[model samples]
Target chain A: MTVFYVITKFLTFPGAITKALFEHIMCKVLKLPVEDTRCLRTDEMCGHIEHELVERPVAGFWLCFIPGLLNFLLGMSLSLFGVINVYCLGNYTGFIQNNALLSNLFASALTGNANLVSTVNFLLPILFLWLGFSMFVNMAPLPEDALMMKEQYKNLNGFLKVLFAPSYFVMRIGAPLERYGVTFILFAVIAVVLAIL
Target chain B: MDNENKNEELFDEASAIEEIEENDQPDVSVEPEQPEQEQPMEPETEQSVEDETVERLNAMGDEIDAEDLGGIPVTPPDDDSVDEETESELCVMCGEKPADKSFGEDYDLCADCRKRLVKAPISFASILFFILIIGVCFFGFLLSASQLSTLQAVSDAYDQAGSNHLYSAIKSLSSAGNIGWKTAKKAVSLYNDSGYLSGIASMVDAYFYDASASSDTKLTWADKVGKGNLNAPWNKDVKKIYSDYNTAMDAYEKYYAYFSEYDEQLYYGEIAVKDVPYDELIQKYETAKQTETESAGLAFISYCEWYLANMCEKGLETELQYMKAVQEACPDFTWLYLTKLTELQISAGEYEAAEANCKKMLQINADDYYGEYFRAMILRRQGKYDEAIAKMDAVIADYENNGFYYAYYEAGINAFLKNDIKQALSYIKVCYEGEYLNYNTANFYALLNKLDNNEEEYQAALDMISSNQAQLSPTVEKYLKKQITAEEMFNGVGNPFEQPAAESEAAE
Candidate 1:
C-alpha cells in the first residue's frame, strides 16, 4: 500500500503526500479494486529485465568511454541529408535562386570536394535512424493483470472507468524507478550539460 | 444461480439493442401504419422468434399512431414507470433481471456482483477532455510565441533596411522644415560621416539660404565655403550641377508667370505715360510756368517729375527725355503728381508709402483690381503673406471665384517654398481646377504631380500646357513667354533621369 502510494504520487503529483491523496481519491471516488492498486514493482514488471541486468556493466562502460559517438554520427547523417535536399532543390530549374543558403550549398557542391560530400551524406541518415530507435525503446506496455482487476470492480458509473485506465498505466511505468536508477541519472547529467553548454 | 445469470445477460443484451434502435430513429414525424393480416410461422424455426418481435413492434407502432390521431401528445415512458409496468424488463447489458432482486436495487447486475462493474467510458471521456484542454493551451502558447517572434523579426528587418546614412539625412531634413543652421550642420556631419560631399553642399544650398541665414552660422558656413573646406575630405566626385539648376530655373519660371501678369498690369499706368504726346505738353507747361510762379511753375515741376517718375518706375529710363518733355507741357497733371510720389516711395524703399500712392490712384478711380493686387504685393514684400492672402481672398470672393487666381498660384508657390507640400498641393489643385491657365499654373501642376510621384500625369499636364499655349490670354502668354523659357515650356520640367552608375559613384 505504501509502495502503491509512492508510485502513484510519482506518476500523478511528483510528491509523497500528493500521491497518497491521488490514490485515496482513486480508491474512494473511482472505486478501483484494492488488489489491483499495488504499483507494479520493477522485479515483477514486464520488459527484458534479465537482459538489462546482464548487459548493464558492459553497456555502461561503452556509454562512458564513447560519449555521444552514436548521437554525433546520427546528427551528421541528418545534416548531410538536409544538405542534399537543399542541393537538389537548388539545381532544379523551377526552384528560385533567391534563397542564399541553398545557392551557397550548391556552389560548394560544384567545387568538387568528395570528402565533404561523403561526410555530410553519412551523418544525416544516422541521425534520423537513432531518433526513431530511441522513441520506440521508451514506451511501456499495457498490463493485462491490471485490466483483469479493473473488470472485477466494474460499475455503471462512467467517470470512474475513464479515470482508472490511464492512472493504472501511469502507476505501472513509475513503479520501476529504482531498478533503472543508474540509466536515468546518466540521462539527467547529460541533458543538463547539453542544455547549459 | 449461474443459469439465471446467463438468462439475465441474454435479456439485457436483447433490450440494449432495442434501446439503441429506438434512439437511432428520427423523432419528428412518421407515416400512419395500416393493420396487416396475421400469418403463422413454424414453431421450432429461428425465424419465428424474430418474426414475433417484429410483429409486436409493429403493433406498438400502430398503437402510437392511434394515440397521435386522437390528439393525445406522446410522452416517453419514465425509467421507473417502465420498470413497474414490466415484471422483468431486460437489463441493458444482459437478457433478464435477477430473480431474487427488486427492480430498483441491484437489478442491472446481481446483488452479489454490483460492486464489481466500473464505468470505463466516462473515465476515458474525462481523461480525454483534460488532455485536450492542456494540449489546446500548449498549442495556443506556441502560436502566440511564434507570431510575436515573427513580428519582432520583421520590425528588426525594417529597422535594418532604413538605418543607412542617406535615409537618416532624408528623415532629418524632412522633419525640419526649411532647414535651420543646426539641421544644416547635422546634414553636413552626416555627409562627412558617409563621405558624400556633392549631396551635402547641394542639400545645404537647397534648404538653407546662406545670405538670409542667422548671423553666427552664416559666418561659419561662408568661411567653410570660402576656404573650400565644406565638402567631405575623402569624396572628390562632383555631381552634375546643371540638371538641378535647370529644374530649379524651370520651377522659378512657372512661379514667375503666374504672378508676372499682375506685376505687369499693376504697374501699367506708368507705361501708359509713354503714349501721351509729352513734347507739346512740356512746351505749354514751361510757357505757363514762366507766366505764373507758385501755381504754373509748381504745376510745370510736377509735370516734369511725373514724366520722369513714370519712366523710372516702369524701368524704362532710356525714354527719360520724352517723359521730361511731357512734364514741361502738362504742368498741372494729377497723374504726374501721383507718379512722382510713387517714384520717391519706391526709391526710398518705403513700400508702404508706395502702397499709399497706389491706394490714392485707386480712390481717384476705383475699378483698378490691379492696384489692389499691387498693394497686396507690398504687404507680401513686408512679410505678411497671410494678410496679403486675406486681401486677395476678399477681392476674389467679391468677383468671380477665379478672379484672384494668381493669388492662389502665388500662395501655392509660397507653401511649396515653405515645404508644406500638402497645403501647396491643395492651393495648386484649386488653381488647376479653375479656368485660369498660365505658365505658373502649368509648372505648379508639374511640381505637384512630381511630388505626388505621378510621372505620367505630370508629363501629360506639361504636354497640355505646351500644346495649348496659344489659347492662353495675351497677358498670360506675354508673362509666360518672359518668365518661362521655350525649352522649359516644351521639355518636361526637372532633370532628365541620369543612370544609376552616377548615383553609385556618388554613394562610393
Candidate 2:
C-alpha cells in the first residue's frame, strides 16, 4: 500500500477510504475547482486534490475506478449475504477477521457479531450512511465547475456529448444542482439498509 | 366462579365423554331383573336433573291413564293473591299505577317512572353506553381468566415433560390451546414484546412445542435402540440449532444495540472481546480505553487481551507479559480483573508481580474478599502449598458464602499431585456441593472417592460424565472397581492434580 493509503486507512473511519475516493472521482466528474497555493486563487482550471490528476493523466482513471468499485462493494457488502464468514477465530470463538478476500487472503477485517449496536454493525453501517450522506451534501457543483461546464459544453464532440449526457444535463443546472433528487436517493438507500438490518 | 367452571367444563366436555357414558349406561341397561341398578349411584343431593329425569319418566307412565287433558294447568287460588299483590304495588316514584315489577319486593314502580328514578332521564345512548361498559368488563375478565388457565396448563405440561410423560404434556397443551385460543394466540405473538402474562404465556407455547419435538425424537431413537438397532443413537446434530438462525440473530443484534445505548459496558465490553485480527482487536481496545464515554469500557481491553491470550494458548511466559501489560495500561482495572490476573501471574511463576497485583487489587477495593486468597495463591506458586492452605483456611473461617471453595480444591489438588491420597480425600470433601461440575471438578470427586474406597460416590461422579466420553478416559477408569494400579490408570493421561488438558475442540 502507498504511504497515503496507509495513512488514510489508519486515520479515517471504517468506510472513509471508499468515501474519500468517491469524492475524488466526483471532483473530476464535476471539474470543480480546488484551492491551490501555487495558483494564488481557486479557479475552474485549478488542480484537484486526487494525486493521480497531478502525477499522471492515465493513473487518474485507476484512482476513479478502484475506489469507485471499492466504495460500492464495501458499502454493499454491509449485508450479511454480500459479506462472507470465515473460521479465522479458534474453534468455538466465531469470525475474527471479517473482510473481503485478497488473492485468497483476508484484505479488510470486519468486526462481525460484536455487540456495539444491536441493530447496526460498528464499521459498515456508519460508513454506508456517511458515503450516502456525502453524495447529498456535496451534490452542488462549485461555481468554477459551472463555468467549466460551459467551456466543456462548447468543445464536446458528438461521441463525448452522448457519453456525458447525464452529467451534461445536470451541469447545465449550474451551481443549484438540486439536492432533492440526491436526498431522495439517500433516504432510499438508508431505508433499504435498515430493512436489510 | 360457577359460570367460569361451567365454561371450563364445556371446553373439556369432549374429554369427559367416557365418564358421561359410564354414568348413563347403568340407567339405560336397568331392567326388572336389575331394578336395584336403576337407583342413582350418586347421592340424592348430588344427582343431576338428567339422572332424576329417568325416574320422573317412570312415575309419569304409571299416572298416564288418570291424567286429564288440559290446555294449561291454572291454579285459581294463587291467581286471587297475585291480583291483590299487584294492586298493593303502586308506582313509588309517580304513584300513578300499580307496578309491573317490584323493586326489592318492597317499593314498586311503573317501568317509565322506574327508568326516570334510577339515575337520570333515560336515553338510548345511556343504555347502550351501560351495555358497552359491561361488555368491555366481561371481555377483559374473560381474557385474564383464559390467560391464567393457559399459564396453569403450560406449567403442568412443563412439569409433565420433565418427568418424560411427553404425550400427557402435549394433551394438556391441546386443552390450553382449545380453551384459550384467542388469549394463547395473542400471547404467542406478543409474548416477548411486553407484559408478564404474555411473556409467560408465550414461553409455554414455545417451550411446549420445542419439548414435544425434542421428546418425540428422543423416544423414537430410544424405541429403535430397544429393538437392538445399533444405528439408532440420539442425533445431536447442532446445525439444527442454527437453522434459520439468521432471523434470531438479527433480533438479538437489535436487542444488543438497544441495550448498549443505556450501558456502554455492554457495547464496548463485547465489541472488545470479538474475535478479530490481533491489530483490529487491539485497535478496538485502544479506542475503548481512550473513549471518554464510559470509564468502565477501559477495562474491556485488558479482559479481552487476557482471554485472547488464553484462547491462543500462548505460553505461561506470554500470559505473564500480557497480564502485566494489562495491569500497567489500566491502573484502575476492576477488582475482578486484578484478582483473576494475579492468579494467572502466580500460575506463571510471576510471584513478585502477583504479590504486587494482589496489593493493587487490595488498594483498588479495600474490602475485596479475594485479596488474601490471591496472596495465598502466590505462596502456593512458590511451592509453599502447606502455608498457602493455612492462609486459605484463615480466610475461609470468616467467609460465609460458598461462592468458590478454591482453598479446598487447591489443597486437594496439591495433596493429590504429591500422592498424599489420605490428605487429598479429607481436603477435597470441603469443596463439595459448589463450583461447576465440569469434567475436572467431577474427576476430582471421582479420584477422592476412589482413594477413600467409597464405591457408590465414585460411581455416581463417574456416571455424571457418561454423557461425555472424555470424562471416562482410561485414567478415570481407576475409579472403577477393577484390579488396576494407580500408575497403570494414569499411564497415558497426566497426573489428575494438575488441570487436565481439554479435549480437542472438534471432539466437543
Candidate with best TM-score: 2
Report the TM-score of candidate 1, chain B only.
0.28
Q: Supply the DockQ value of model 1.
A: 0.02
List the DockQ of the predictions in order. 0.02, 0.01
Off by over 4 Å in 2: A1-197, B1-299, B363-367, B401-403, B417-419, B467-470, B473-508
The DockQ-based CAPRI class assigned to model 1 is: incorrect
- List, in order, the clash count of every candidate structure: 43, 5
lDDT tens digits, residue span A1-197, model 2: 23332332233223332334344444444342222212111222111122212223323233333443443444333322211110000011111122112212322232332332212222333333444333332333333434445565556687866776665554445233221233334444664454322
RMSD of 2: 44.0
Interface residue Cα RMSD of candidate 2 after superposition: 30.7
lDDT tens readout by residue for model 2, B1-508 = 2444333332233223334455765443323323433475756577554435445645554332212313323333334678776567877556778775533455456767644433332234433533543453343333234344545776676575555443345546556543222223222322222112224333333222232243534433212211111121211111122221223344334333422332454234343323335455545555655652332233344555555555445556656666666556545434325666776666656678778877765554333446677776566555566786777676666454644576666666556656777787776666545664555666777777877789898888767656565445445554455556443432222234233355311112
